[model samples]
Target: MSNASPSVKTPLYAQIGQRIGQMIDAQVFRVGQRLPSLRDLASQNGVSVSTAVQAFHWLEERHLVEARPKAGYFVAPRSRRPALPAVSCPPRHSLALQRKSRTETIAVFQPQGQEVTFGAAYPVVSFGGACPKDPLFFDDDRVRVALARATRIHRHSLIEYSDSPGTQALREAVARRALHLGCQLLADDLIITSSCIHAVGLCLRAVTKPGDVVALESPTHFGFLDLLESLNLRVLEVPTHPKQGLSLPALQLALDTQPIKVVLSVPTLSNPLGAVMKHSDKRALVQMLASRQIPLIEDVVFNDLLAADERRKAAKAFDQDGGVMVCGSFSKTVAPGLRLGWVEAGRWKDSVSMLKRVQGGPTNVVLEQALADLLSQAGYEARMRRLGALMKDRLQEARGLINDSFPRGTRVSDPSAGYTLWVELPGQLDAMALFQRCVAEGITFGPGALFTATDRFRHCLRLSFAGAWTDVERRALARIGELARRQGDAP
Candidate 1:
């Protein structure tokens, strides 16, 4: 229905809805902004009130507008352009990664069923849409087919522990996939792991010992901090730009003053902040680290989501001397339940592969084969393109709601790709307190405090829109905004 051109074959009401969608897209009417009343629209377009109602129904179905109780239809928050978050300037020193208690870890997510799992404690808070767990996000039938085929093809492998370096077919598939990231990986060097985190863990073990200082962008994935803490490593968070990503100058300063061992970063479509370092910046970062003999654990997990294919190139693409350890997974972009990932460990290739062989065994041959089958699909790019478009829509609506309901000083990241959003609430708005409140109302998000070892992000939070897009999710976003406003209003 949304794809119908404004031609004669299109229904009149649909044509009206399409026009309104165009207006909303053009920002002639802001998201969360009201539209003409049914009567007003009917009169303006010389259509019946029923026709106007139909037009609004069409708009609502497309997420272009929403109706309020006892009020006429108003434009939905569908604008993806939110005010970008301010640059982050964390303390210039390194500190040991702190492993907070279960209580604190629980605050990172509320009760949810989509992409997250929690401990046996309190009720889960709803992420509205956390991970894309629902079948709506993937071709489940195709996934089942691939899995079945892989099992049939590799049934004999069940009798043995799979090859330590993963199946050659899957590794070759991974190498072929990495070409889009501009990395010509050798399938022989690629080691498939349980997941991306597993690959990163191997890299960390190969390079840094306990108490080693690793520099990364601020307000990063909490999972990284959890890994560092478990490994007994210290974290030096470089000041990061919300849009541009890690500050090279700040990182160079830290390296000059501190004993930084390794730099872990997501140069393209970084997590939480969704920042993408420029191509030149990526090269410069590689050169800068290579000169200092520091290994860069570059994560290209979300690099595929960047709107432009050229921008999707991983930082490892510029690694002249085997200095960048690149890791990635298909869970975010493909079937999450598959639980598979791969890595090219640069200079530490043998060490990482050996670590995987000893510490964590290779991924199941059936799963690897299934993933290989999925990757070999001719329509994979089209599937990702659709997912990318869906993410843009969700991000736009989320930003609109944040603009409409959150406190005035609130700022959110505006990324061209990716499903996660970083929201910086107004002054004195404690995100932890806000999380507690949101949990009560069945709405939850990752508080900024959990993202770092520092207390600097006390007023920020990260939200993901990878879950199913439903009215409940939409209302949850509005409720979160309302609850945040109340936090500031509290005495």
Candidate 2:
């Protein structure tokens, strides 16, 4: 055999193209800004001038970057795409919409009109939305193998309806995973749904009726609040802490004062604030709810992304009276497109199952089988380890940037786990107004108002560093700081 190891086939033009592409994406060349001379680029990347020219030509062909005579190459302006249609939801009443007229007005909803999506608590990666960076990060190879096996075993099953309760294998796997979290469950205790949101909807339908009161965390998930409102349920906001999570004393007060029927919270790595409740507190909460017989809807989407030793203990772990209904999903961990989530309804299993059947019949059978296969392949743990490390590093970078770039008096809530950062801006700078400015600059973020029950966090905002590049995050922070300073200095 030759000592030359198969002459590692290197394509010089392709390498040049990739480098230029990255530079454009990094905003090294702004829209309508001229690129450096081909000779300079060749010298910089150590390629021939012709190769650099060829790369620019390829970019032009793809409409990614354009060449201007004497001005050189610049990033092409992206074509504006049509907006997505507004999601049709049934009319309902809640604090968010109750302020508006009671008349059935179909508000023209367009997600594009919203500025700085930091208001929404989705992970911000290149792909955008709440999708994870590596869909197969937790044993992609295994998922593929399992998908193949499932396909062979159940042909045309993809077109058929899934088991009303969900696949036995997947449910068993979920039960096993729940046991690890200190909840004793069997396969029958589970009801699979399309996603955590779906699971929440099912739980809500099972317990509360129209016009009934439900207690929610002060700075809770907006989707949950919206869902409750759509179902015509009255929402009572309970005080919650930024670090300790939902305040038990406040919760008790609310339960005592209001005729609340359901309590919804994310006990682990709570969205926006990223706080995890203590085990003792969880036990107390479980007991408190049990005493009132108030149904608890636990959203644990971020449960699996915990740091190795600090895995949060769930409220379901302490449910001796079976009032806690735990909802979790693989969307945040495995593949969001799969839309696989389950609810462990201790005593409400039957109700939840019936709700699932009524809602949309059943979940996708093929996808569930694929996820089950993915979990069983023994690669899930290693994948999580790598993902956890990446998330930690990214979050640290984000925190450092915020601290260094933000103006004085700005406070940041440091999360022990998860990829979100909740920041309180200085002075009377409104987050919503700041978001509009950010949108004008082609940057997006979550406003703090959406996270709070009252509009008290008007100066705060939430950011996701999960999918953003380090340089992009730095620029965004700097821009935000400048805007904040300007707002503060104004009369």
Candidate 3:
């Protein structure tokens, strides 16, 4: 057979696709709007008919455009567009009624960076997204030795399916570590998960049926609230304190009156508020939950970030009747991309482990083993110490900036641990509006409303100092404060 020549590549098709994508992004061709016919597009893009056809086919496959029989390609309708499930909320009067102009209703201040992402709870700084900076005394040698050991022992098996409960060594490490928290857990008590979020999901699936009522912190982690909504669970909001954590009395009232199956909360280092439950409150709450047989899901992702003395206490520490399902993750302390987290399922270990199997078969074995190896290193504890100091310093720097720059009436939270600062703005200043303005300026943050069932904290905002240079963060803080003042002054 004669050799065939390679087909010539077409640049025109790519250019046409780019143009169409740009138009879609800019909303020049809005959702549901009919796209130009192949003939028309070829004429407009100055390309051959085949080139335009190729481009349209490419776009259609990627879901940016949809082909309609006899109608040609139209911008995908809203229903057809790929989207995250709509987060549910109770109906409320629109904020539009308060402002004279619709434009005025939206915050105009732009954070010095990109999109209006303040609605999402993430740190504006690069480092704020995940683990904190390591301190001066971290021992890298120990980590290396541990990895070497894991490799020598596991070798080929590292790539194979891990036991449902995770590596025995890792489970034992976790159980031994739990002892510091006053939790007397055996290896059997732990069910390893990909992340704390996964752990929470498994616990939810294990305990409650779909449509069961779950009580959550009024302004809790939006991710959890969204998860509950997706699982078709009805959420009942329980009021929480900004500093002391969830309200015990309110939780007690809800427990007594409502048919709540689970209470999800962050007893230590809450996401937006940076609240830590008092020891007495933790005892009372645990007792209450145990007495009522209510499962308490404690998100302790930030647990290890606490100072040494603080490590001795945990919500699980006080669970006399195994009512607390403690979920902890190395993502916050180590690396998030590693996705190493575990659930100390007090009484629901088998149920959670089974759910883990159903959800994704099993987590990445090599990654989990790598993390286990890293933990085995003596350097892990030293690295944690260093991270703690750096975080403490960063927290102080961010707190000072907020206190100095924010408007006079603004109340900044005084968190004993964790890198988040919760600022309570004047009632008139909507954090969501402020978020939009900041996003336009190239900054992003976690808005207050997403954390709550009601818009009760519309005036509040959470800032993370986990990442970013001190100079950039200080400037961002000053700009944020100025924006708050402007919004507060606005009629």
Candidate 4:
């Protein structure tokens, strides 16, 4: 895999460009397919625009891709084809849920109050990774200006506790934004919460009580598992496809067989697998929930990150009987430090609002106003576009690395949007063992066991490509592959 020659070293940009060629040869990208924007390619590969330009030129010279005027590069015609990963098949049973024991915890956490320094867990090019704000995408100055302006302009509202369901201005902003997701909303239906997870928790509390059976995707989000466990709920995990968000038929079967009370899901850009449910499937899921009279707590946090407009549509958009409760936050798509999330509970709006009132008071008016300003600003859409392109590039880069370094039998999910990747190694490879070894080498990753109630995905793991693809981080990923290979080779 070493591309460097004996006499001369290959440039990083050249290597990246060559990787793109390999992808084209392998038919991972098809003929006439548009390439990511030049800036996006640069950001994803951790190179400069000039470097990406050189890379593209190199591809052009080799006849792998051709540039179109005004449009981006596209893959040239080729004969070879590349195979995609297979869909996932989770076990068909409810699992005994347990909390994370101290010993089971991965040793990747730094001491509290320590200033977070990326790639600082080890010396000499460390790779201990955590989900941090990418400077390439987020503009810190813009956020600061918005916060300062809000504090100055809304100083009068700081003295008193606002409405229990959040400020009207912020709700109106959210309602306006929901239109893009194909959701029709009124500000009165929205209730702001501390965070997205908090919004989900509130929705769960509003509908179901302790000991109730809740259905969710197999290999679901770890945070949802923790929330369900904290609420003393049993889990009936429905099988999920890597490409499709959830298996509707399996969920229907579960509904018929199990005493399911509430079904929770992240339909658009689901975590770990990064699955974006098809639009038709979203509508079908909504109707199914309505037919059963079961409420669905749909997490649409990653909806805005989707590339296609139709893909960004919320499951609640198709809910005819108000059976879907949509929850979302600005942390993933917008400002992370704001700690703001909202829920639009259809029929159970009063119940969710009541639960919020009992659990906590109103959200900060100043922060709400600031987020409102940010969301309403014209620059917001442009920022989202840049972010989407950046993530697309990073995903392609990481996937290339995974294919190059991992074992031959390894498979990775190709999500339509978002920064998370679900990797399935060969059967014999234990993700927990790989996680421990990677941690020993000062690299951090999420093992698959953490995301499930059962031991179904012990051979799987999740990686977040949210950060910059610096040399250290890239090397760390390769190092993880090496460690996994060693583990796989063991007797």
lDDT of 1 by residue, 180-294 (tens): 9998999999999999988898999999999999999998888888899999999999989989999999998998999999999988888889998999999999999999999
For all candidates, the clash counts are: 5, 7, 19, 0
Give candidate 1's whole-model lDDT: 0.83
Give all candidate RMSDs, comma-separated: 6.4, 12.2, 21.2, 8.3
Off by over 4 Å in 3: 1-155, 309-312
Clashing pairs in 1: 80-396, 110-124, 110-125, 111-124, 111-125
CA lDDT of 246 in candidate 3?
Answer: 80
Residue 326 displacement in candidate 2 (angstroms): 0.6
| Most accurate candidate by lDDT | 1
The models' CA-based lDDT, in order, is 0.83, 0.69, 0.68, 0.79
Best by TM-score: 1
Q: Could you estimate the TM-score for every candidate?
A: 0.84, 0.74, 0.71, 0.82
**Model 4 agreement with the true structure over 1-60: per-residue lDDT tens digits:** 112112123457767887897788687899999988899999999888999999998677
For residues 153-177, write the lDDT of model 3, one tens digit per residue: 6688755665577877778777776
Off by over 4 Å in 2: 1-130, 134-145
In candidate 2 the C-alpha lDDT for residue 59 amounts to 67
Q: Using lDDT, rank the candidates from best to worst.
A: 1, 4, 2, 3
Worst 10 residues of 2 by lDDT: 101-110
Write down the TM-score for model 3.
0.71
